[model samples]
Target: MNSSFGIKHIAQFILFVALQILLVDNLVLFGTGFCFIYVAFLLFLPIGISRMWLLILGFITGFTVDVFYDTIGIHAAASVLLAFLRPLVLNLLTPRDGYDTNDSVNIHVMGWRWFLAYALMLILLHHTAVFFLEKISLQDAWYTLAKILLSTLFTTTVMVILQLLFFSPKRERVDYR
Candidate 1:
């Protein structure tokens, strides 16, 4: 990681970890589902970010969440999976040439459709991996799948709202150049 980017990355990761564990953890809606805003921290990494760095962030994010929940390696594995597939997801949705260095993956800049599809796909992948890893022994795939989908939908909603309010590109278009 570039030294400057490393600082920002760590700050974002810590903020997300704290937010997810402290606030969102208690904001459970249905008994079975809750929002996890932390993953978006990883999701919002710049398009040009190194693949390795993104994976590292994913590992840290997942591992932190796992530590809070007392699961063994569920978060780590799922996070790595999500991080690995992130580039693939971006490629599939927007393509490499389509994204600018400053362009965001959030709802506003990418439009409702691209943003929704991108977030939905990754959330599904991450949640499914985590949910199933946690349930490795039981193997009740249906129940696990349901939990993943439900929780992801809720979490993705929070992500969209946050994107709209905080990181949306509509506010400032100042050129970095």
Candidate 2:
């Protein structure tokens, strides 16, 4: 990848983590929905990134959040699970023409339907792993399921808004000779 792409991703990683720690962490809704915006960073990573790097990045992102949340690596494990399943999800969602090397997982590039499906599935999986790992019991399966579903919806909505507000493609000017 180019230096600019690398820098952009690094900046995004820091931004998402900071947002999660500072803002989204305390922004729970209905006592069930928790927005894990940091997962967006992992979900939006370059489509062509290798599996090994993706796994490492996943661990790093989750571990960083784990450190601040003091949740003893729950975030790390969930993030890693998200990373491990990402490729399979992509393959399942692949377009007939396939993805361009430069394509990203944003709405502008992938359209609302594809992006929503992508975000929802991954976020659901991430939240499921997280809440289950935290609860570690089926005794409160109903509550845990509620938390997972609500959090997935909340996170997916925020990710879509963030993509629309900030990650929109910049238009280029063309001059006819």
Candidate 3:
């Protein structure tokens, strides 16, 4: 990353993680769903970032949240998993025209349907990893599933709203080269 981009990402990382730890993490919906907006930091990372760096950053991000949440490794594990899966997910969802390396993963850039689908898949996976790891047993399988679903929905919804309110589409026209 260039100096300016690195600084921008660092600032975003601090902001998202802080908001997650201080606010969203505490706001559990119906005592089950937790809003993990911090994942957006991972989601919005520049396309084609190295997998190794993504994983390392994911772990660090998750570890930071784990420290605040008192759940060691759970967040780290989920974050790493999400990071590992991100490229694969992007590939799977790639349009015939392909994504611009400079483009961000936001509704404005990708369109609402694509953004929703992408965010839903990642959020569900992330939430499932988290709730299941926290539970660590099938004793409350139904409850775990419910928590995963609800949190996934809640997180995805918040992400869409954030994109709508905060992110603007890239203005440069794609060349389709």
TM-score, candidate number 1: 0.86
List the global CA lDDT of all models.
0.78, 0.90, 0.87
Q: What is the lDDT of residue 61 in candidate 2?
A: 100
After superposition on all C-alphas, the RMSD of every candidate to the true structure, in Å, is 3.0, 4.3, 2.8
Pitting candidate 1 against candidate 3, the one with the higher lDDT is 3
lDDT of 3 by residue, 1-177 (tens): 566677778999999999998788678999988799999999988776779999999999999999998997999999999999999999999988998876767787788888888889988999999999999999999999999998999988888888888887664332213
Q: Write the per-residue lDDT of candidate 1 for residues 77-119, one digit (tens) a residue.
A: 8888988998999889875457776654656667888888888
Ranking by lDDT: 2, 3, 1
lDDT of 1: 0.78
Question: What C-alpha lDDT does candidate 3 achieve relative to the native structure?
Answer: 0.87
Q: Which stretches of candidate 2 lie over 4 Å from their true place?
A: 170-177
Clashes in predicted model 3: 0
* Residue 11 shift from truth in candidate 2, angstroms: 0.6
Quote the lDDT for 18 in model 1: 93
How much is 52 displaced in model 3, in angstroms?
Answer: 1.5
Relative to the unseen true structure, what is the C-alpha lDDT of residue 20 in candidate 3, on a scale of 0 to 100? Answer: 98
